[model samples]
Target: MRLGSLAYEQIKERLLEGGYGPGQRLSAVELGAELGVSKQPVMEALRLLSADGLVTIIPQVGCEVARYELQEVQDFFALFASMEGTIAGLAATRCTKAGLRGLDAVSARIGHLASETDPVARSHHYRLLNREYHARIHALAGTAVVGEISHRMWDLSDFLINTSGADHPLHAALDARHDDHETIRKALWDRDAGTARREMELHILGTLSVMRPQQL
Candidate 1:
């Protein structure tokens, strides 16, 4: 990979993993030291991440992790759920038998995560595994354009979920989240597009509840 791309991926990884908090200042010089590169590449990376809505770059103030208000987060997830529901519906109609098996494998891995003891580790791994589960659905959708658009949104979703100022986000509800996945999987296996779409929408909106444990 190119230097800029490498810097971009590493920085984005930290943001999604909660290595950086929402609105936390991101010093390019410090990051360059850690990445063993100059500030230039890091700045380029931040700029790209900014475009992805994971970072905020202000001309005079420098860079920071992107932050959104509570209402913004709510609005984002609502829009996100609708888009993902559409993709799930597409996946239901178009996925091959082999593709369905691959999805089952990923879902099983997520199920295993339910037994994990560490909340932080479980949340981190769940974020990754959950992405895989949805990415499999995106692949089954068979539309590169839709997949590309959905993926950009997914990146933002991760940044929001992991950086939502909640140390235990999705940590306490592993079983419920896993149960949501099972229902979606069964719907997909049955090739029930209507059920898949509705189930996926409900499952996604449920993310807000986990994010705010008070609701859980």
Candidate 2:
């Protein structure tokens, strides 16, 4: 990959994975040194991330991770829930045997997280596995346009959840989240469109409960 794209992916990955906190200052020179690149490509990456609402760049003040207000976060999740619910509905009818099996595989890994005692590891691992579990459902939907849009939304979802000033956000809700997954899995397995859609929306909006209200 080009240096600029590489920088973008690296930076964006950190942002989604909670390496950077909301509104934390980022130094291009420091990041360049870390990535073995230069300031130019680092700045290029920041600009791209800014366009995706993950970073904010100021002319004189430099760049920091993006932060959203409580209402904005809630609104984003609401929209995200609607789209994902639709996808789950489509996935209900479009799911192939192989796709459902793949989803179950991911969910099995998530189930294992309950035994993971380390807070950071459990939270991080759950975040990633939770994403794959949903991505499997997305693939089953066989959507091209909305699936593309949902991918970006998923990034933002991770960003908000991780940066909401809650330490171990996913850890706090691990058991509940796993239970939600089981409910979703059963609906998908049964090919119940209504149940899948309803369960998905509730599961996503459930994110708000664990988020810190003060920092949101």
Compose the digit string of candidate 2's lDDT tens values, residues 1-216: 999999999999999878998889999999999999999999999999999899999899999999888788889999999999999999999999899999999999999888999999999899889889988999999998898899999999989888887887999899999999999999999999999999999999998987886754
Pairs clashing in candidate 1? Answer: none
Error of 2 at 177 (Å): 0.7
Clashing pairs in 2: none
What would you estimate as the lDDT of candidate 2? 0.92
Measure candidate 1: CA RMSD: 1.7
TM-score of every candidate relative to the true structure: 0.95, 0.96
Which RMSD values do the candidates have, in order?
Answer: 1.7, 1.2
Let me know the TM-score candidate 1 reaches against the reference structure. Answer: 0.95
Candidate 1 per-residue lDDT over residues 1-216, each given as its tens digit: 988899999999998887898789999999999999899999999999999999899899899888888888889889999999999999999999999999999999998886799998898888889989999999999988988998999898878777766776868777899999999999999999999999999988888876755423
Error of 2 at 77 (Å): 0.4
